[model samples]
Target: MDRIRRRRTGAVAGTLTALALAVTGLFAGGTGTAAADTRAVPQHAVTGYWQNFDNGAQVQKLGDVQDDYDIIAVAFADATGTPGQVTFNLDSAGLGGYTVDQFKADIKAKQAAGKSVIISVGGEKGAVAVDDAASASAFADSVYALMREYGFDGVDIDLENGLDSTYMTQALKSLAGKAGSGLVLTMAPQTIDMQSPSNEYFKTALAVKDILTVVNMQYYNSGSMLGCDGKVYSQGTVDFLTGLACIQLENGLAPSQVGIGVPASPQAAGGGYVFPDVVNNALDCLAKGTGCGSFKPSKTYPDIRGAMTWSTNWDAGAGSAWSKAVGPHVHDLP
Candidate 1:
C-alpha cells in the first residue's frame, strides 16, 4: 500500500503552549461523575474496526456488528475544514437506508451489551493533525462532541498520515479531563511506527499510558522489520506477531496494553493475511509461551490484551471466519 512513503509531513508546533498548559495544571482534573459511568473493558478483549464506508466489504449497521468484538471502533471520523478537528457522518444511504438514529441506537445497544463503541480518527488515508495546542484542543473537543452525540465510549487514533507525540499527548490528556478516567483510548499504529520507543507514535502511546487502553499495532502490510530480539522478521507468521509484539511488551507498555492486530481476511489487506489459526497460535504463543513458531518471548505475558482486526465487515464477507475463531480465542487467553 506504500504506507511508508505516505507519512504525515509538518514541523511540530505549539510546544510552548503545550508545556504551559501542562505547567499551569490545565491538564489536571476530570469529571468525577463521568468516571463512574465509564464502561469496563475485559482484560482479554478482541477489537474490530467497523467500516463506516463501504469498500467492497459487507455493509453493516452498528447493530449488525457481532457480539464477539468487545471494542467496535467506527472506521473513521473525517477531517473537518478546521485542522485537528474531526466529525462523523454515518453513510445512511450507503448502508442500505441506515439512519443516524438507528446508528446511534446501535451504539447504545452495543454498550448496553458490555461492548465499547468508539470513533477511530485515522486510516490508510487519514490526515487529521494535532500538532499544536489550539489544534489539540480542537481535536479533543470535537471528538468529545462526537462521543456525546453518538454515545461513544472513547476515541481511537489510527492516524496513518503522521502524529506529533507532544501535542497528541496534550490533546488526549485534555480529552481525559473532559471525558473522565473511563475514556477508552486506543491506538492502531503501523508496525514500523512502534518498532522503537522513540518514535512519535510510540511516544504518544507511552505518554498517555495511564488512560490508554491497547496499542493494536498493525502487523500486516509491513514487509519485514526488526523485533525486540533485534533480528528481522517477516509478516504473516506466528513469529512475526509475537516477535514484534515483544518490542512493545519489553518497552514502556504494560502487558495488558499490547495487542496483535492482523487482517481479518485476505481481502482486508494487501499482504500479511494469515488464517485464523495463525492468529490464535500467535496469541497462545505470547500468553502461554506455547504453540510458538520460530520466535518466542523471553517470558510469557499472560495478561496480554488480545487481538484486533482491520475490519469486521471483511470478516462477515468471509462468513465471519476471522471473528468466529479469533474472537473466542482472544477471550480465552490466560
Candidate 2:
C-alpha cells in the first residue's frame, strides 16, 4: 500500500501500530509480527510502565490483573498541566473510567501478589512539551497532584517533547516524595547527544537517579536522536536499546534502575502503544495464524530485565495478547 502513512489525530494517529491492520472483522496481518500467538519470552520483574493505548476492555484487563510483575504504570499525565488548555484526558477513565477504588484495589492486589502499580504521567501527547525545564516542572506538579489524590504507589515521568527534563528533575524528585509508600520515582529521559549532553540530559539523569526508581530510555526514540547504532548494531535484537542501557549505566543509573523502552507502535508512526508492537503483531499473527504478521518482543530485545508495553488492553482479544508473550522470558531477572 506504499505505506502512505495517514496522519491520524494525535489520539487516533498515536494509537496506530506498525503491525498495521484495519480490522476487517477481527483479523491479523504482517511478517516479523507473525501470528496466532508468541512463545512468550520471560517477562522482566523490572517492568512497571503501562501506556493507555487501549479502548474499552480496560476494566476487564484490570479485573484479571495478577502480580507476577514488579511495577505497573498506567498511561496519562495530569490534565491541569496539559498542552494548550485541554484538561483531564489521562485519568482513571482512560479506558473505561476505572474507579480510584478499583485502581487502588488493582495496586493492592498486584502488590499482594508481589507487583507494583505506578501512575504514568505525560505520554507522547498527554501533556507537557520540552520547551524548557520550568514548563516541565509545572507539568510534573500537575501529575504529582493526581498521584497524591488517588493514593497511587508512584508516578512515571514520560514527558516526550515540550519541556527539557533538566527543569523538571528537581520537581520529579520532589514530586517523587509526594508519590507515597516509598513511591518509585521513575523517569523517562530522551537521549540527546553523547559528546556532551543535549539539554544536559546525562547530568540531569545522574542528579536524579538516586531518588529515581527506574529511568526507561525510549530506545527507538533515543536511537533517532542518539544514533541508530543501538538498533543497527549490538548484541540484543534492538542494539539501540542495548546502547541506551550503556548510556544510562555511564550516567550513573544502575541496571536495576534502567530499563530499555519498547513501545507497542513506532515513534515515527505517532508515539502510541507503549507496549511492544512485536507482541501485538505476534498476537494478531497467532489469532489469524499466518494470515499476516509483523514482529514479537521475544524476537526483539532478547536480553535485560524484560520489557514494558503501553497498556494491558492492547494485549486484548480471544488470542494475541501481551501477557501471553511474558511466558518464556518471565524469569529474565536474577
Top TM-score prediction, candidate number: 1
| 1-334 per-residue lDDT for model 1 (tens digits) | 1122122222123432332232232211211111122465898889998888767889888888878999999978998999899999888888898989889889889999999999999887878999999999999999999999998999999988789999999999999999987899889998868866778998998888888888899888777666666666777888889988887887777778889888888877877888999999988998999999888877888888899987888889999999999999988887
For model 2, the run of ten residues with the poorest summed lDDT: 29-38
Tell me how candidate 1 scores on lDDT.
Answer: 0.82
lDDT of 2 by residue, 57-90 (tens): 3334344543334666665544554442212343
**Per-candidate TM-score against the hidden true structure:** 0.89, 0.60
Error of 2 at 130 (Å): 8.5
Candidate 1 — which pairs collide?
Answer: 8-161
C-alpha RMSD for every candidate: 8.1, 12.3
Query: Given candidate 1, what's the lDDT at residue 41?
Result: 84
lDDT of 2 at 114: 55
TM-score of 1: 0.89
Which parts of model 1 are misplaced by more than 4 Å? Answer: 1-38
